[model samples]
Target: MTTEPTAADAVGPEQEAVETALVETVVASFDHCPDPRLKEIMVSLTRHLHAFIRNVRLTEQEWAAGIDFLTEAGHITDDVRQEFILLSDTLGASMQTVNVNNVAYADATEATVFGPFFVEDSPRVELGGDVSFGAPGEPCWVEGQVTDTAGKPLAGARIEVWEADEDGLYDVQRDAGRRAARGHLFSDENGEYRFWGLTPTPYPIPDDGPVGKMLAAVGRSPLRTSHLHFMVSHPGARTLVTHIFPEGDPIMWKDSVFGVKESLIKRFEHQPAGTPTPDGRQLKTAWRRVRFDIVLAPAGA
Candidate 1:
């Protein structure tokens, strides 16, 4: 016993009713939002999202499974790790989006995924100090410089480095003897920096999570090539988080993250020994030499 103007109702009431009900529901459900920007974002998101559903005829099964996967992802995360990042990595979304946005193809240092092992607040160590925790492996010296796109020396640039030991395991993964195979160093006035650490060996990501489950389902290995992770930053320059693989490593070109750029592959030259370091510290034995050159974008670029 609803009465409506015939002509007006034909073009308006039903259609208006449906849209009003949907948009109102969205606003009411998301009333917890505090920021105006977030409100706008949710509004537009719901509108376009509904349009997508109408266009795609999506299935409920797919949506339910997605929610289930994400729920399990949350269950896997802990204080020392993030399973969501691993999911992003396995789906190629992490590498596709983060590693591409600040890419440097022309004389600039290429970027890559900063994996889950990166911990903050690494100790500051002297140039060429051995980062090896008590275990002995190959003796190696890693030297590098941080510069800008124009090749100008960058002073006071902070280059933070961490890598797996020769056994392809990080300090956090092993026993008490595994304390500090990672540290941060600042480039001197001449833009030069160097450190003594075991050359990193290729290793695989954790194989106990859903990402690992999915990879196993697809017949893929989680192996990343032997490389060292560098997170370099300076005032006014775009921070660069990346890695360099040994050029001759068999898996260098097949890194699971697909982060390798040809220009970033370094070569390790085995040398007997060189002159005593300026600090006059002598190695217990002969060591290998690995050279790396890092290029950073201008600050605030």
Candidate 2:
């Protein structure tokens, strides 16, 4: 006796042909796009998206849930908080983009995620000045030199820095009109710079939203490793955005945004409370120090 066809068996060449035809139709719709790059991207995106749907055999309910998740992500985003960036970071898209754009050059500092907290028009600071600006954290003396990939000094390069406090909170996360633990300084004629910043500390990404829920659902931690953020820019060189992870951070390998690189990890030396600071500032509490030499690749290299 012959058996009747089941649902799985019924989904054969006819269904596949229909699905493939749909993808082709969508891709063809962009054929008239005037911009070549846009047309290429849209065509590829349509093909990949259709392929994903087919591979998963996505259910209507699952598609609707994804739409809801993105909608909530948009709702939670604001001037200070960027939920979409959080989503991209957690999904590793941000790092992938960084890798694509930041090709490696000899001894050039590796790039990483540009977290959502950076602000425009940060207060400018003199060399050796304090960036902490009264943010609550253990004192940290940070010194560095900026150079080109060829080892030529890059004087006057603007180094923008920011980080969370000892309590793992950025200045923007606290009361409005408050700014601390962040500032910018220009490298001196010798390509050297120094500043007082808070000791690096591990912090959770702002997770009171959809991104947090997704991480929890996937059994993933939202904690980033202890780090300090830096954005170095100079004329005729590619701008560098990166983080320096403390060498001993327990979660350095498990950073929520995958921002840590072995090359970016540096030692933070501890100094006794009574030890004289490099610039002769007296402190009643122990402080840490770190040195990070930055090298920038030539633009468009």
Candidate maximizing lDDT: 2
User: In order, how many clashes per candidate?
Assistant: 4, 0
Put down candidate 1 lDDT per residue, 144-166, tens digits, no spaces: 88888888888888888888877
Worst 10-residue lDDT window, candidate 1: 3-12
Spell out the clash pairs found in candidate 1.
236-299, 236-300, 237-298, 237-299
- Model 1: lDDT equals 0.76
Tens digit of per-residue lDDT, candidate 2, span 185-210: 99999899999999999989987999
Q: Each model's TM-score, in the order given?
A: 0.77, 0.96
